[model samples]
Target: MRKRAKKHNYTVIIERIREMVRENGLQPGDRLPPERVLAAAFHVSRGSLRQALQALAERHIVESRQGQGTYLLADFDSVLPGDAILEKVSEHDNVLHDIFEFRRIIEPEIAALAAQRANVATLNQLKVLVYDQQRALFNNNEVDQFDTQFHQLLVAMTGNSVIAQVMQAIQAIVDTSRAPWLQSRKRRQMSIEGHLRIIDALEKKESDGARRAMQQHLAAVEQFIFDNQ
Candidate 1:
């Protein structure tokens, strides 16, 4: 859970750095503040800030010089803007619908397979993920990370590399849509409850029950996202 939380913090810091780039009119090759300054300004530990910077470096968005400091490697405008979140959703309405439709068809089957094949270790991991989701709720943090992990873990449990690849393929758009869908506390709570029910079915090793639980969960989530949109 601490690991997940730290990962979340890194993500937050990375996004904030992007925002800072745009807000401050940072250009490619422009140097960012020193690590210490950035850490203080961002109200995060230097270690956490460094992790975030390392992530950006991995993405080729920024680079750290030897004893020089970090510098922007790309323009922030090339990245998706926060304001584009809903706009992208609205623009790709049909695509989004099809994605949800695909999930509805695929994820339940995955859940069913997981119920049959999941080992004790795998089940325990899923429980920890859902528990992390509960903790995120209490901490008023985003639950989507854990939610995504839980679903992906279920796919992995199915023991089909092809199915796992398929899930990974659609992950980007799924992530885009999920951000707005999960913005509401009610929706987040609903997601947690849905995951709990699916976990219960999996724990009992009831493939049929897991299938039903997953189908119901996806249906409700899809309805809410489309209805409220």
Candidate 2:
């Protein structure tokens, strides 16, 4: 009974920390409560309290920056969603498909521009992005932060700040979608393979090939989107 009670106590403490974070409107860069203070307030050992924080971090609700402190993650939930509307908002929506359409127009141009102007370092960065993504997908880390870097680096190669900004505006939706889209058996097998073809075209300075490869890749995205429709 004592052990069970202790478990319940820690769970309650974790919930309290979550509430405090929301109450303060904390963001990704915002520091969380210091360990000693929070543990003291909860009348719990630092070890148990850290475990609770770890749980929250895994859910992307918080983050810890080295030498700084634990931070409240900037995320969808930080938008001040009321509890009743939260679950409803998570369901699929058409906004993401629209973003994909936007990508269709922009991604090919970005690829073409990248072919025309990307320096050796930038082209190699694209290669690394594809390779790193392949590794992540194979390692089952595809749903992690690597997906963001993969797409972002692809666009970054174009050196178009405005295009990058447009992409960043819809970043959350794109990041959220990558896992479910990639989870399709077809993509799980060969998504990286297609991306590599694009990288190869870009590296070879083949503008037309890069354009075609990018178009084909995003065409896959379009098919995925409307297929769900």
Candidate 3:
């Protein structure tokens, strides 16, 4: 009975922490209050609070970086078990087809919205990403990080938190599935060209053009994956 009561208290504390996060409007990359502060605020023992935090961490609700404190992840789905989409793709043997189908349904619209809403700061940030991608290519380095950031930034520029969260989740799945295909230089160069077109449309604030560019880009990526496979 005592163990049951303790478990119940722990669950309650976890929910309360979630409520605190929402009430605080804490976005991704935001740091939580110090351990002592959070424990005191929740009126829970430090041990109890630590247990709750560990649960959240396991679920990717929060991440603790050594010497940097706990920070919320941009994608809450990051901690989803292997049985999620990643496993589905692996078991089905049509990973690229599945991922590109999802991108076709979602990313073009994301690009259109980003073109409509992106500010100068966002545009500049995207330009920097493009430059970084090009630099990586020239240096014969991997382009996966910049490519992922480029897409994520587009989703975020849409100014819709719900869409941003959904895309973040989808992207986590895409990242795991694209690992093998991203190793090809031909594919990497083609991706760089596609990114340039998308950036050009966004810079001009042409929503339709941005949408078309993204569609064409994804089509090319789909073809590359199909041919290589």
Task: Tell me, by TM-score, which candidate is best.
Answer: 1
Lowest-scoring 10 consecutive residues by lDDT in candidate 2?
A: 1-10
Q: Per-residue alpha-carbon lDDT of model 1 for 20-86, expressed as tens digits?
A: 8878999999999898888898998775577567656755778999989999998755744463422
lDDT of 3 by residue, 154-206 (tens): 98899999998787767668785456423467777888899899989998999
Q: Sort all candidates by lDDT, best to worst.
A: 1, 3, 2
Q: lDDT: which candidate is best?
A: 1
lDDT of predicted model 3 = 0.74
**Tens digits of per-residue lDDT for model 2, 15-81:** 6775776677766777888989889987887755765665456556667678877877754355434
Q: What do the candidate models score in CA lDDT, each in turn? A: 0.77, 0.64, 0.74
Comparing 1 with 2 on lDDT, the higher-scoring candidate is: 1
Candidate order by TM-score, decreasing, is 1, 3, 2
User: In model 3, what is the error at residue 50, expressed in angstroms?
Assistant: 43
* Clashes in predicted model 2: 0
How displaced is residue 37 in candidate 3, in Å?
A: 60
Clashes of each: 0, 0, 0
